[model samples]
Target: MPVPKDNRPLRSPNEKGRYRRAWKESHGNLLLAFAGLIFLIGLAMIWASPPGTPEIDVDLGTVDSADQVVSLPPNVILIRVATSQLNSEGPIRIAVYDSPHTFGNPEQAIIKDSLVPIDGFVVWEIKLDFLPEQFAIAAYHDLDDNGELNRALFNAPVEPYGFSNNARSLVGPPTYEQTIMQRPTESTAIEIRVY
Candidate 1:
């Protein structure tokens, strides 16, 4: 028996080595290109991930200043917030940043979902694994899905902004010093206004 001939042309009949040569030249680069594509895909997934938000019981009394203490022995922290009203769904994120680790950096791993509902006179307590001399607390509602605090094009706009100790209000994020609060190992309360 004779083998049948494949009549159809794999490449243009006129071209001698177009297809095979192209594949040979591109084969090595193809793997690198594919690897690069995979890396980019991984990066996209990480960037698109939802960042965990923290919920701290805001305990605030309209005293001259705000003072708080971390429950010692166990180093448990208590946050008492006193607010007149709540944003419909805004500035819902409150973060406590540990200083020296960088400002506005969240020290607690407690995310802001499936914990407590925003009721009147919100109170939250968290265990302090490591206490720092100072930290910054921020409460904000992520209205836009872009994440991070939203600002105007000129880097100027009035959005929901709050800091530890109810620091000075700004059209944008406040300076590092203003947001810093002394974290002593005692029950301390910082006054914050709901934006």
Candidate 2:
């Protein structure tokens, strides 16, 4: 037989089998150690993170259970949304905008909330401490629960939607100026109707 590439005598069949087993065991051990190291590093990074870092809760479902109770802060703005012709079951989504530039931009909304509708209405309680002096709200009945307002051709909304002050527009969406509401001194309530 030709010499082995390492120039070492070839091992007997039994020795080769034993060596292969030993190599696999050592390789597995190394992998396990590497995995442990990675896990420890992750734990250290998490421990070093700031205490104020917000925790994100992800819900895959369309609506949170109606029984889940959220304690409202002392300062809050309560929004009551009424829906007309709501024929399906899904969460109602609300977006609060703090500036004219962010109005109607879901990605830039200062606050976003979803609530399960009850008897054609949903209530959202938002903390007032961090909000600006003026803000606008845009809400929609998410009939499909796709996390967005479904649109038809020419970007016409296919779902029921409304803006603060019951604002409406003949062309596209209402301007931020038309829908803006001033923040109240104390906890206040506002109503929006989505058609």
Pairs of residues at least 3 apart in sequence or in different chains that clash in candidate 2:
none
lDDT of 1 at 18: 74
Model 1 residue 105 lDDT? 49
User: Whole-model Cα lDDT per candidate?
Assistant: 0.52, 0.78
Q: Output the lDDT of residue 82, model 2.
A: 75
Best by TM-score: 2
Measured over all alpha carbons after superposition, the RMSD of each candidate to the real structure, in angstroms, is 14.8, 19.9
- Model 1, 77-154: lDDT tens digits are 655443333433332456666653455544452223211226533445655545457666766545443346666665
RMSD of 1: 14.8
What TM-score does model 1 achieve against the real structure? 0.45
Per candidate, the number of residue pairs that clash is: 20, 0
Tens-place lDDT digits, model 2, residues 1-195: 567989988776778689669879789778889999999778655533323523333221234378554444468877888776446788889999999988888999999988878767787777787788999999999988999999886687888898999887656788999999988877767778776
Q: What TM-score would each prediction reach against the true structure?
A: 0.45, 0.60
